[model samples]
Target: MLRMLPFLIVLALWIWAFIDCLTTPEEEVRHLPKVVWVIIILLFGEVLLGPIAWLVAGKQRAVRGPRQTPWAAGDTGNGGYERPRGRQLAPDDDPEFLASLKKDNKQHEDMLKQWEADLRRREEELRGKDDPDAGRRG
Candidate 1:
């Protein structure tokens, strides 16, 4: 047991550093991938470089958006900013307004799906073009 003291000290140091890394907010935390973060921390020691990682790693939310202008175009009826239907619907609400929301949501979802599919297809094409015989078994 006495011979393991050095190893235990190393383990304690690692635990302390890792906790410091996690306690930090995600946004403030460095955006680099895990592998990169590991390399940086390991290459740099606690006395000299440990503070760098502690300084990073925290959530950084975007600034609040500007308030919407009531007079904005398309927001009101008769060429003014008009609230879209269903925004203030009662329990017994307008079917047409609900339909509009459903349509808009469906369109958005469809577009997102299409974009994801296109990305996958492009990636596959790139792999195939880069090494035409990459998958061949010899």
Candidate 2:
């Protein structure tokens, strides 16, 4: 309550330059057109010259530089802006998804060795039938 510190610092710089000129991106809105810099930060917002001319000439910011990342900086063709090439990493470091997971683990080990040779030929016909006329043929 210190005499409303310069009207709360000009209402937090007119709500941070009207939310940074409405999230600054209509192609980096420069000298004037993101709907006339949101109607000059809502009509000369209280008088700090339209949030100081939208934080000095409304937007065109960029200037960042170092952290590459478009898949290890491949696409140098900045115009079309491709950039994506390698270093993505997962799916077990993807060499064509680990060669289609080693050809589906060799077709699931040849269908588990033909279902363990049809469960050992159905356990050798239930252990060669012990004798009920050994499956009826005298």
Candidate 3:
């Protein structure tokens, strides 16, 4: 196991370099085209030359400070920064959606009131027809 450590380390480095080369954006790659870097890494990986070259000169790696919000990344339309990962609001939690729902509820309530008033008026008319002398008695 101890003897295999060096080989394992080399293998891991080769794999990491290959993946990094492939995943790194085309614009970020420096000194050579991204495709060339990939070919180099694959071709010279056994000797540790390609991986080392890639790590040293393949891409422009930004120095990270504390975790930054996407806005703080200072994206200047160059696709060089991360975007915000804001969570979506639920419908009930959305103020505009809730306001619309309240407006619909108010309209329905108004219609219900009108229907109730019309029903009462119809009932009164029916009673008047049933007892033509009701108003005369009063």
Candidate 4:
């Protein structure tokens, strides 16, 4: 039972990954070809290929319109953020607003990195706990 447990768990994970890959759109999956993804699903199995696909070849690039920054939302961390009282804001040269926008973007990037690191830590912990000889190699 103990020996078979790992195999069963791995098989389950492979099936789940394969299903997920099948559902993901070809356009959204990057790096590898769509056929390669299928082969990964079929050949390497989920436990290995899922993470590989995600890390090395995932998430198609997208073009987007102008971003909405905190500056655009009328929030600068400074004591007072001034929007044009009369007709309109000048097209450019708003230092305070631009600075705030840059700060917001940096913070968001930092948070995303932290989240990825946290998730990686959790996965490593789970894998470590599952190590077969951790209890006693003797």
Listing every candidate in turn, what is its Cα RMSD in Å to the true structure after a full C-alpha superposition?
16.1, 16.2, 14.1, 23.9
Task: Output the TM-score of candidate 2.
Answer: 0.26
How well is each residue in 36-136 modelled by candidate 3, as lDDT tens digits? 99999999998999999999998899988898544554564337533534886789888978999999999999999999999999999999999999979
Q: What C-alpha lDDT values do all the predictions have? A: 0.63, 0.82, 0.89, 0.71
Give all TM-scores, in the order shown.
0.32, 0.26, 0.52, 0.36
Best by TM-score: 3
Better of 2 and 4 by TM-score: 4
Question: What ranges in model 4 sit over 4 Å off?
Answer: 46-56, 59-138
Q: Tell me the tens digit of each residue's lDDT in model 4 across 43-70.
A: 8774566635644565454679788654
Candidate 3 global CA lDDT score: 0.89
| Ranked by lDDT, top first | 3, 2, 4, 1
lDDT of 2 by residue, 1-138 (tens): 999999899989999989888887788888678888788778888888988887888887678989865445445565675564566668887698899989999999999999999999988788676555666674
lDDT of 1 by residue, 52-127 (tens): 5534452234569998665566546555546665457664587867888899999999999999999999998899
User: Which structure is stronger by TM-score: 3 or 4?
Assistant: 3
Poorest 10 consecutive residues by lDDT, candidate 1: 51-60
